[model samples]
Target: MANKRTPAASENDRLYGRALAVIRMRQGIPQQRAAERLGVTTQAWQNYEAGLRKSIFTVDGLSRLATALDVDPGLIEQVKGLLKEGVSEAWMSDGAQPLPTSGSEGKVVFFSRRAEPEVPPAEELAPVYGAVFAGKPGAIAFTPDRPDDWKPVHPNQRGYRDPFYLQVHGDSLSPRFEPGELAPAVRGVWPTRGQVCIIETHDGAMLLKYYERRDAQSVWVRELQPEPREFGVHLADIRAVHAVVGGAVS
Candidate 1:
């Protein structure tokens, strides 16, 4: 027997089709032209736009579609709202079962169908630390003193947790970053390759650069400025590492 489509999946298909139609119309591109740009047959594209067919665009396909439509690929995810709405409606219509909040084993299981609890506003401010360099060591040490001189940033504004800010100085990371910019770093979050991060050396020095890779003995980094420069430091010399959430020009 064939499986049936769930309400959430059906809603997703409908929303995707509608959004695709709207984007195509807004771009003033005819169905045939849009289909050709997407490298699909006219009938297949029409069926997709009419919600008769499901969308199966891969990562590269989505990028191509976004390029042809002149829109960001992330915009396609907006259809998720339709799935959420469908789930809510299904829970209401199908009489959702509520499991016990606490089980005999002293455990708790929360159902997704239930309304989400209210989240309090994040009002706490994160402190900005002293400047971290992108070059060789300076005479100054990495100090957390003088909280009065630091900038206080709201964590909710950037979706960060236990965030601390740092000032950027030197030209090694120029073009992408400039001196006097406030870089927000989230504690305890490990950064992947190509992400900007704050690196603290055991000798009490701090640096900010793009994280390249790390091995058992050393951490490699890159600086994109006048040109790309790569370097590595022994793990023994490193104190701590934090991912740079974002930054603002001061």
Candidate 2:
């Protein structure tokens, strides 16, 4: 939950900002551009910052404000009643955060912090044996919020599910999948022939290849489409060829 701050209507918590945000977001209007339409300078519009405080405007101004905001004129009256009566903006909002963030292609945005999947609660997991050294086995439990620069358990390989995400680094496997693409190779389910499958060999090599298990003895991997005389078949124990991603939508 976020911190909630409600100001009296007479106070300078500057509820104007919230009003401005609502006005801009509700009407789908840009800031400076909306200011121009309202015949107010940009800085003057900035002074109407909404999140900080409660505010009041002239009845006539409120009428024009409602028109520009594309909201009911009575909304101003409602704001007055709620702000004066000490109701939090969040309360009237019906439990949604009021923050403006950016989206792809200059779209309005919101931030989300979702919890991890399949992780057991502290009560569900076994208790810790002891606070051991960093080098000790089983020293570190599940840490979902890993630091950005921290390397995974495997430097060259990746696992898609159950403690794995493939962060592709070098360009050796480029042309089909680009470098730096987080092409996570999960274990558990392998795809049918000619689909993207993250495979691990018996020799401890991890690879992203389109798989074709022609028979039980042969595995044909085509990272890139083949040309003439390109013998793409490699015979090996597939060890694990779990999970295909990005090849199909459903």
Tell me model 2's lDDT, rounded to 2 decimals: 0.42
Error of 1 at 170 (Å): 1.0
Model 1 pairs whose backbones collide: none
Model 2 TM:
0.31
Model 1 Cα shift for residue 175 (angstroms): 1.5
Task: Give residue 81's error in model 1 in angstroms.
Answer: 27
lDDT of 1 by residue, 2-44 (tens): 8996344365566666656655554456889878877889997
| Best model number under TM-score | 1
**What lDDT is reached at residue 165 by model 1?**
77
Give a tens-digit lDDT track for model 2, residues 20-108.
Answer: 45445534566787577567776656655543222326566665555555443555454444444454554334212222222335444
